[model samples]
Target: MIYLDNAATTWPKPNQVTEAVAKSMKYYGANPGRSGHKMAIRTSEKVYECRELVADFFGLSNPANVVFTQNSTMALNFAIHGILKAGDHAICTVMDHNSVLRPLFAKSPDVDVSYLGADSEGVIDPSELEALIRPNTRLVAMTHVSNVCGTVTPVEDIAKVCRQHGILFLLDASQSAGIIDIDMQQMKIDLLAAPGHKALYGPMGTGLLCINTDFELAPIMQGGTGSYSKELTQPLELPDRLESGTLNLPGICGLAEGIRYINRIGIANIREHEAKLTAYLLDGLSRIKDINIIGKKNTLGRTGVVSFTHNSKDCVDISSYLSSNFSIATRSMYHCAYKAHEALGTSDGGTVRVSLGVFNTLSEIKILLYALKNMM
Candidate 1:
């Protein structure tokens, strides 16, 4: 099968990732940090190694600042709920996934929110953000890339505005974490969240939240953090402050191996390969008379995700045909960004999403194009 839905969750993860996860489950089944036994210590060390690797990959100064969660949604929830309080205002863009939008809306009824608009191509303007910023704006949460449209937001420019106003900047790097370069120090990002199942090539149930030491967020979950067993209150340290209960050691072990693989292969090389494949798909889809490609015409300002719609075919039908008849997997829907679809004028029916991964090749894209043409 030719899988093209890497944006949702990567498939055929790197062999190292699978091997590492299996090894952890089979060899070290002990709960990390719960005991001082050899097995427990070894498990704890592996988890810390994963944390350090994630910190290095994201250019974070300290590994302790990184907190592991179940997925990006959980990390986002922690950042949103922990940072904002009643009567505070936050700014976000329409291109954000529901993971970011829902929590902000669920804030105290007294809290205020501003949903900034994006262009037809799903690009958010820095000036638009500047105009929306208010004195009461405590945080500005936005995504690095639109999962539906594949449009890369101007994060650095937005970060500049947030820095100038002294507002907390929260970046949802769900789409761009492993593929794009993100520097926490340079971007002035106070909180960053991402899922390991996507570009990181890790197993599911692994996510990360990096909090800047200067900013303190309340703990969303409180329990025995292993550090403050005697105290009723949770520890106020970097990781133990947020990470409660036993972490997913097996998933984190795979995550560490995945980061190492990315480091060895180089992120730039992976970016180049995906960009070329996206460009090739765009060129091929553009040739079909009845097809309409979405987002930026070129792959310069986008990740490996490509979205398009055909004149006569329904989006769901196309995806079904691809999966059943052609054995080519694709995603068709709002992509969890209903507002983004409205902004891009695809509210009638969401576009077909073809997301390439590091393992994807030109040959797979060519086969997908041929399949699309045959369907047309």
Candidate 2:
């Protein structure tokens, strides 16, 4: 089957990722850091190894600042809810997923949320963010990349604005984590969240939230962190403060290998390949008589994800046609990013999304184009 829904989750994870997870479960699946046994110690080491890799990959100076979570949604929730509180104000863009939007929405009337608008191309001006900063503004939540439109937000510039305003910067790097170059320290990002399953090519049920040491937020959940066990209250440590319960040791083991794989291949090479594929997709889709590409009409400053809708055609019908007839897999409907669809006027049924992965070849693009053409 042709898989084009990688924006949802990457398929066919790297061999190293699978091997590492299996090895962890087989050799040292004991509850990490919960016991002094050799197996538990080994599990603890393996989990820490992943933390170190994630810290290094994102340019975090310390691994302790990284906390493990179930997925980007959980990480995002921790950041948005942990930081914004009563009488405080936060800012986010319309392009953000419900992960950011819903949490902030719950805080409405108490914690003010000012939304910055994105254009038809799904680009938000960095300067506009400064205007949204109110005196009570405590944080600026931004998506590193738009999941629906694949529009890359200008985070560095936005970070600069947040810095100038003394507001904490929260970045949802769900779509660009392993695929994009992000220096958390250099970018002045206060809280960064991402899923290891997507571009990282790790197994599902793994995510990371890297918090800058200088920044502090209350724990969202309370439970055992395998540290300060004798104490009744949760530890006020960097990771233990946020991460409660047992770590996903096997998943973290695989995630470490996934980061290693990305490093070995180099992000630049991976991005270049995706760029070519995105360009091909855009140009070809443009030529189709009844097709209308979403967001930027070109590949400039976007990820490999391309969302398009047929003129006067329902996206679900198109997706079903492709899947049943050509064995193609595409994401239809809101893509879990309603604000982006509402901004682009695709809110009814949204657009058919094709997200290319590192393993996707030019031939796959040709087949997808052929299938799309036949739909008309």
Candidate 3:
């Protein structure tokens, strides 16, 4: 099957990723950091190695500042709920996934939130963010890339505004973790959250949240963290403060291996390969008269994700046809970003999303184009 839904969750992870997961479970399945046994220490080392790998990939200074979570949603929740308090104002763009939006909205009614609007292409202007920064705005949450439109937001520019205003900058890097070049130091990002399954090519149930040392947040969950056992309360440490219970050691091991694969291939090289496929798909889709491509026409302001709408065809119908008849897998519906669809004027009928991964080939893209052309 030609899988094109990497935006939702990547498929066919690298051989090393799968191998690493299997090896971890087979060799060292002990709960990491819970025991002094050799296997437990080895397992714990695997988890720490992943944290260090992720930290280096994102240019984080300290691996300890990185906390493991269930997924990007949980990471976002920890950041949103832990950082913003009642009566505090927060800023977020319409292009954010529900993971980022729902947690902020779930806050007490006393907490105020400003839903910043994005342009038709799902790009929010830095000046607009600058205008929305109130005296009480404690945090500015934004996605590194729009899952629906595939448009890359000006995160660094927005980060600059947040720095100037002394507001905490929270970046949802669910779409840009391994695919894009992100330097936390250069971006001045206070908190960055990402999923291991997507760009990192790790097993599911793995994620990372990198918190800057200067920024302090309350713990979202409290329990035995394998640290500060003498204290009745949760420790005021970086990762232990946020992470509780047994960690996903197997997944973390795979994530560390996946990151090593990325480092070997080089992010720039992977991005260029995916961009070539994206451009190829875009050119092919543009040739179809009935197709209306969404997001930036050029690859300059976007990732490998491409969304399009077809005339006289429902998105679900086309998606089903691609899956059943052509053996092509794609994503339809709101993609968990209902507000983003509404912003792009695709709320009535969500566009078909075709996202490329590092392993996706040009031949697969051609086959997809052939199927799309036949549909017309």
Candidate 4:
């Protein structure tokens, strides 16, 4: 089966990732940082090793700044809820997923929230944010890439604006982690959150939040971090402050392997490969008389995600037909970016989303195009 719903979660994970997960469960199952036993020490070392790897991967210097979470949603929530106060104002884009929108919505009435509008092609301007910034603006939460349509955000430019205004920049890198080249320091990103499961090729339970700035974020959850056991209050240091309770050691091990896999292949190569496939898919879709490509109609400044709607067909119906008849998996509907769909005028029923992965090939895209044409 051709799996094209990678924006949701990547399938057919690399062999090393699965191997690492199983090996961790079998050999390194001890609770990390909780004890001084040899096994526990080994587990702790593995966890720290992953932390270092994540730091290096994102161009950060300190490994302790890396905080592990269940997924990107959790990481995003930790950033949103932990930073914004009652009187604080925050900024986000319409291209954000519900993960960002809902958390900010929960802070309504007390916190002032503003949404930066995107064009029909899902492009957002960094300059427009200046007008919306209030004196109390504390954070600017923006996605690195649109999950619904794969439109890349001008993060470096936005980061510059945020830095100039002393507003914290929170980047949701859920769809662009391993696929895009991100330098936290160079970009001046304050807080970056991403899932290890999607482009990172890790297990579903693995995610990470990388803190690059000195600004402190309050702990959303409190429990044992294997350190600071004497005090009832949470620790002041990073990672420990945000990450409470026993960690997901096995998943972290797998996530480390996933990053290793990306390093082995190089991010530029992965981006190039997916770009070719996305361009091919877009070109093919353009030839179909009834198809209307959504978002940026080309491959420039985007990931491998593409969404399109049929002039006469329901997006869900087309997705169902692909899965049933062609054994192809594709996502349909809002894709959790209702604001984006509203901007693109696809909110009525959304669009069929085709998200390519590192494993996808030209032939797979060819078959998908063929199936789409035949279905029409």
Candidate 5:
């Protein structure tokens, strides 16, 4: 099967990542940081190593500031709900996924939300953000890349605007992390969230949240943190303040291996490769008559995610046809971002999203192009 729904989750994780998860489950499956036994200590060390690797990969200085979660949605919830309080205003874009939009919606009326508009290409203007800043604007949450349109937002410029106003900057790197170059420290991002199952090539049920030391967010969950066990109140530490309950050790083990593999292969190579593939797909799709792409025609500042729709075909039906008849997997729908579809003028029926991954080859894309042509 040719899988092109990587925006949902990467297909066929690396062998090393699978091996690590299996090894952790079979060999060192003890609970990490919960006991004094050798097995527990070993598990603790492995988890710590993963934390350090993630911190370094993201240009964060302190590994303790990173907290593990189930997915980017959880991390985003913790960042959005935990940080904003009554009367606190926040800014987001229409291109934001439901993960960000829904959380912000839940806090509406109490926490004022200002949504910045994007053009037909789903690109947010950084200059417009400066005008939206208000005295009560405590945070500016932005997505590094739009999961719906594959448009890369100018996060660095947006972060600069947030820093100029002394407001915290939260980045939802759900679709950009590992595939895009993101420097947490240099970008002055106060809060960052990402899913390990996407470009990171990790197993599902793995996610991360990193907070800068100077910024403090209220604990979303409070319980045992394997530290300061005597006190009922949550520990006043970096990650312990955010992390609660038992960690996903097997998933994290795979995450660690995924990061290691990315490091070995080099992020620059991965980014360039994906960009090339996206450009190829864009070119091929544009040649087909009656097909309309939702975002930029070129892959100047985008990931491998390409969303398009045939004028006569329903996107859902087309996706089903690809899967059932051709064994080619593609995801179709609003992609949990109805706002994005509305902005792109495809709210009636969402576009077919063909998101590529590291394992995909040009040959697969060629097959997809021919299939799309025949369908047209």
Candidate 6:
């Protein structure tokens, strides 16, 4: 099968990641940080090692600032719900996913929100953000890349604006984490969230939130952190303050191996491979009659995701045809970003999305292009 839905969740995770999960489940099954037993201590050490690896990967100096979650959605929830309080103001963009939008919606009348608009190509101007900032604007949360069209945001420029205004910047790195080299320190990002299952190639149910040491957010969930057990309230430390209940040990172990795999292969090589495939796919799609390619037509300032719609054929029908007839896996519909679809003028039936991964090859692209051409 030719899989092209890496933007949702990666497939065929590295052998190292799978083996690490199995090893954690088979040997180190004890609850991390729950007790003083040797097994528990060992599990805790493994978890901390993964923390250190993630911290180093993202250029964070303190390992303790890394907090694990079930997925990027959860991490985003913790950041959004925790940071925005009553009477506070926050800013986001139309390119953001529902993970960023829904939480801000939940805040409702208690907190004020300003949405930045994106051009038809899903590109935003950093200069537009300065005018949106209010004295009460506390945070600006946005995605590093558009999940719908793989449009890369100008994060460094946006971060600079946020820093100059003394507003916090929260980045949702769900699509760009492992593929793009993101230096949280150099970028001056106040908070960063990413899923381990997407570009990181880790098992599902694994994500992380990296926080700058100076910023403090309120805890959304309060429970036992295995630290400060005597105190009735949650611990005020870095991770334990945010992390409640037993952590996902096996998932964290696998995530650590995934990060190691990325380090071994080098992210630049992965980016180059995906870019080649994306450009090829875009060229092929553009050649097909009555097809409209969404977002930028080229590889400039974008990741490997490509979305398009045919004039007559329904996007779901095209995706179903590829899956049933050609065994090609692709995504259709809003991609959970309705605002993006509306902004791009494809809200009627959404678009067919072909997102490439590291394991995909030029031959697979050829087959996909042939299938699409024949379908047309």
Candidates in order, TM-scores: namely 0.98, 0.98, 0.98, 0.99, 0.99, 0.99
Q: What is the lDDT of candidate 5?
A: 0.91
All-Cα superposition RMSD per candidate: 0.9, 0.9, 1.0, 0.7, 0.9, 0.8
True lDDT of residue 236, candidate 6: 88
- The digit string of per-residue lDDT tens for model 5 on 97-132 reads 999999999998899999999999998999999889
Q: In terms of TM-score, how similar is model 5 to the real structure? A: 0.99
TM-score of 1: 0.98
Give the candidates in order of lDDT, highest first.
Answer: 4, 6, 5, 1, 2, 3
Stretches > 4 Å off in candidate 5: none
- In model 2, where is the ten-residue run with the lowest total lDDT? 211-220
Question: What are the per-residue Cα lDDT tens digits for candidate 3 across 118-198?
Answer: 878887877788778889999999999999878998889989888888899999999999999888998899999999999
Report the Cα lDDT for residue 182, model 5: 84
User: After superposing candidate 6, which stretches have Cα over 4 Å from the reference?
Assistant: none
Report the alpha-carbon TM-score of model 3 versus the true structure: 0.98
Root mean square deviation (Cα) for candidate 2? 0.9
lDDT of 4 by residue, 122-163 (tens): 999988999999899999999989998999998999999999
lDDT (C-alpha, whole model) for all candidates: 0.90, 0.90, 0.89, 0.94, 0.91, 0.94
* Tens-place lDDT digits, model 2, residues 1-376: 9999999999879999999999988997899888999999888888888899999999998999999999999998888888878999999999999899999999888998999999998998898887788899998998988998889998999988888888999999999998889999898898999998999999899998999747677778999888898999889877889888888888899999999999999999999999999999899999998898899888788899889988778999999999999999999989778988989888877899999899898999999999988776
Clashes of each: 0, 0, 0, 0, 0, 0
The positional error of residue 285 in candidate 3, measured at the CA in angstroms, is: 0.6
